[model samples]
Target: MPFFRWARIWVLSLSGLVLTGSIAAAAVPQDMQDFNHYTFAVMWHPGVCATWSNAGPACKDLSPAAKINQEWTMHGLWASRPRSLLAAGMNGPTWWHYGCYWYNPEHALPKGSCANPPLNLPEALHQRLYAHMPMAQICLDRHEYYKHVVCFGETPEQFFPKELDLLDKLNASAFTAFIRDHRGQWVARNAIMKAFADSFQVKNADALELRCENPSHHIHELERQGNILTQAWITIHKDKVDAFPAPESLEKGRKGNCAEKIHILN
Candidate 1:
């Protein structure tokens, strides 16, 4: 471990702040320890709304002309640990879970925007964020900013526009169209992965981790609706995040808890 990171750890303990340190090194695979990757996540808006309790804030009051309502929504652009935090000995998974809190233990990660300081973003970028990520309506933009963007070592001005631009490019891809085509219908997981592979022209789809919601356990009324595609977690090489989906920027990710067949809800 680097000297500065160790010093930070010692100072944090002296301050008596509770720190959820990185997971056990022995328990995690060697590759997972380095955790140097970016997860470019986007959610399927309608499917996200379908499984939640009364449709969460992201889905509420969504306009007929809302872009998020009709397309896959931006979830976040997360780097496991950029070089800025790496020298302080912060590991990837810890950064993924705790973010800025890992580096600045005093700044609590807020459940809502009310407790956090507002982001320093332009009005236009704010509007773009809201359009691409409806959860921004509830100020998740602030949450994402503090938790992840700080690691970028750049102002909200430099960061958000770049990320949203990537989302625009992704939206124009065949992968986006495939999800739209399957809305309110069933899609095979392999077929979806193949479409993603084709869209990015990657060697395979292992770079994308699929997340789905099976609301049956919680909402018994929707018991028969096995699974709804909710989020796509595409692993990007940390060094190549901005050049995303370039074959060199890809990495294998953990494919999540979806069944072989997924239903994309609209």
Candidate 2:
């Protein structure tokens, strides 16, 4: 399966890093390791492809016939548009892997607005600086363009005073509190879960249970343990099992990974 292949490489590389002292070698929390393993299995496994007949609803929705074909049109537009970095001669896949498929750059928050600033540098400068950054899986979702107008690191007051004013008009603190309280339910409703599940060919509900019920599933336990730093690392760099938003609202803050992206959709 694709997942096994990825896992083999991942494990081998991690081992090498440990041996070489390139990464601090320590036993990851058991739950975290389990979560990572499960995510790896689901995201990379070809079994999902087989189970879903390669035309899972996520892919199906991207087809020409679906109601959401318009969304795919937007995706295609993003794909075809010229990005600043690539030159005329370099015509290859420009999208980066996030969640399940290639992340269309247009769909991504502009590099200038993404979490990292240096990545948003001028094309020539970016080329020189990021030559060695590892290409790994990432997540992509539809974002509210206005919400991200300010650069990611900047204070809201600095870059988007007007937007912040709008947020204030809407009872920003109340909205944030509500999201914090009910985000999971929204994610369960959103198409992201379906995409996550389809990518992994697993039921979203079952996946959650698997993580929670299996003691060997260390990652779930660690998340439950509330180790903030470890959880943050796992969410940001490894996978975001905790970020799944509530299904009822389309709001952000969904616990996700490549697999959950498909599961929530179904």
Top-TM-score structure, candidate number: 1
Which portions of model 2 show Cα errors greater than 4 Å?
1-83, 86-158, 162-178, 183-219, 222-266
Global lDDT of each candidate: 0.68, 0.23
- Show where candidate 1 strays beyond 4 Å: 1-35, 61-66, 82-93, 111-113, 216-226
lDDT accuracy of residue 171 in candidate 2: 25
User: lDDT by residue for model 1 over 1-266, one digit each (tens)?
Assistant: 45334324432331342222222334322332244777888888876776655445667754535667567788888867555457656666676677655545443455445345666467888888877888776677766766675533446777788788878878888889888777767788899999999989887899989888866344333335546788888888876777876778889988777878887766
RMSD of each: 7.1, 21.0
Cand. 1 TM to true fold: 0.77
